[model samples]
Target: MTDEQPDRKESGFKETTRVRTARERLRETVAGHDRTERVPLDAADGRVLAEAVVAERNVPHYPRAAMDGFAVRAEDTFGASDRSPEILRSAGEAASVEPGAAVQVHTGSELPEGADAVVMIEHADERGGDLEVFDAVGAGENVAPVGEDVESGQRLYDAGHRLRPSDLGLLKSVGVREVEAYEPPSVAVIPTGEELVAEDPAPGEVVETNGLTVSRYVERWGGAATYRDVVTDDPDALREAVERDSDHDVVVTTGGSSVGERDLLPEVVSELGEVVVHGVALKPGHPVALGVVEETPVVMLPGYPVASIVNAVQFLRPATKWAGNLPVPDPPTTDARLDRKIRSEPGVRTFARVSLTDEDGERVATPTRASGSGILSSVALADGWVVVPEASEGIPADEVVAVQDWEALP
Candidate 1:
């Protein structure tokens, strides 16, 4: 761990930082910080609200027909049926209905003035513009009243709310062309390591892929990602790349935060700004690093693919989302019985990937490979992660484990 000898040949690695503290600091660093933009309706999907979206006008602003039929007076239609039908003159489309008269109206068409009810087309017969009503309808039946969906001056969404597709429809219904929302964070993913190759790595070299993977993760987390070239394991080179990427909202570096000989992210982050954490108390992700450089949040992920993915899910994803005031992408959770024993080191929070299946009317979880973090297939073949609390040593077979990141409950 000395400056002269950057590559320390040490066993077990010297890790001093805790995971929870690092996450707490990251939260503090990113909370309530983002720029607002008045984005057009077309580009506002998945963006968080920076201001309340008040209804400019009532949804359906006018009384509209809810069915294709005749708009009539409910009292007039009473006592009218197939056997003893009520006869009335039709006023035609958009025409006002006189007493004992009906107006032709289509679904979603505005109800003619003085019309209080609409009899569906199936319940009424239109013969040469003349109307014969068979079924009676109550006042306001099959009619969308004024402000039926949203009232004018009502706030449809509060600040910090994320916009969905349906939310855009709501705004469009109220004639909102654009909305003020938090801009998505711009992230830079920089992969660092001397042994890393751009592509087609031989036996002695490893392919650099964490940046691409992290860039995609950042994009999925509602951020614009710029994947930077893989910087060699040099403090100056890493520091320069980080400085240049500081224009972005956040920077995520991979493959040099651990206590290994070539791990250099912690030192570079410290020299550039401040290293909030250099290690974590989580298994596989224990080498995750968190920091802030030039007020830009920097997340140094472990070199291992699984570790990088897990830590990205744990830290970077939320940071990117929160920087833009976006909501967290909360995965569905489910509980299942362990199909076999899952072991973990006590005092280290573990995330064991497991594939679950319904066997004998019960959900059974089989553990994935519990080897080194470089094993990507271990997690890819699995459905969800089973959390092993720091206080617990191991979970025995048949024990019900909550799959916190599960897509759905079995």
Candidate 2:
């Protein structure tokens, strides 16, 4: 523990800790435990490849025609032109086509025996039983040489590579019917609160949504999520839920990390496992917790949407990415000027929702009315946001910032 404690007079949480230090611990906990699986090519999308796929054969294994033309030796068309055309007899089979004769061929068709070039169909005129070439072509012209696209035993993809839709087509073209990839990490989220309800809520009960938020974020990082029922602010119930979900790669419990009498997540985590971090120095997310149970990492997020989403974006998503060896997705962003000034407490990171406007071809960002962490619509209505770091004050009006988008660009 620490000699200095957080000043919780203004905040509601009992514990306080640094955000970066806690995140480093979580990263160490999630590394080096990824699992692998073999799946058909159809199921490889969005999966991290565990093995490299190599080409089995040459693409266009033979010397094939690259256009609809008459196949002939380069010497036959060396000086042929519109002014002085070379008339060659059209022969039937390879055995019948002697020197100075052209063989009929189409796109992708194999070149006839002893033919080293092709005269495009448009450049050749059919005259009775012969083809009159009006344009000269050099050796190997208009022909697809062997291994032109891909060579045999060429490495197509390397391990730790994430598969995309276009990657599937390339894998098929390389003659790979299946692939070995990391299995998606499995996460179990258990929401705990006495005043939370599932489907129908009483007059004072709140509908549980943090579990859904955590689960959805987990899935985005190539992880499978299972949300358990709310544990009702009981230590025993929370412990049971955590123990039951130990088989999963990560166990998450939302709510009940405060000093309130009903809050039992911290106590349950301490009793059933080990609580490494009780609170993070993040605004609207100070009560966050991190622990381990039955060799499984457990993350405790605040019940509020703002805290849950930010923590998920900062913590759970990254952990899942490491577990699956996934490539970090790039979020599209735009540079904008702040519409107004915003302030923050020292040594604490804060996130705010902002709506954007185009002011004379320049984007301006204004803070949204939804400042409370529990206001889901605030974030939904926002175009994007600007995050203030822990060591700084707030941004001044007109200060340009990068607003990260919810989706990445193609």
TM-score per prediction, in order, is 0.88, 0.86
Off by over 4 Å in 1: 1-18, 78-94, 121-136, 360-362, 406-410
Best by lDDT: 1
Clashes per model (N, Cα, C within 3 A): 0, 0
**Tens digits of per-residue lDDT for model 1, 1-410:** 44533432353445444567777899876754658889999988888888888999998888999998889988888898899888888887756878889988889999888889999999888788678888889999999999998999998899988888999988998989999887778999998988899889888899888888888778777888999888998878988999999878888999988876688777777778887766788887788878898889999999899999889988898888878777775677778999889898877888899988999899888888555688988876788898888889989999998887632311
* Candidate 2 per-residue lDDT over residues 1-410, each given as its tens digit: 23443323334554567777988888767764557889898988888889888987888788899999788888888788889999898874453246889988889988887888888999999889888999999999998998898898999889988899998987787788889998888889888888888778779989988888678777777888997888887777787888899888888878886666776776677778777777788876787878877777888888887777777776777777776677767667889999888777878887767888998998998988769888888876888767788888888888998887753311
Cα lDDT listed for each candidate: 0.83, 0.80
Candidate 1 steric clashes? 0
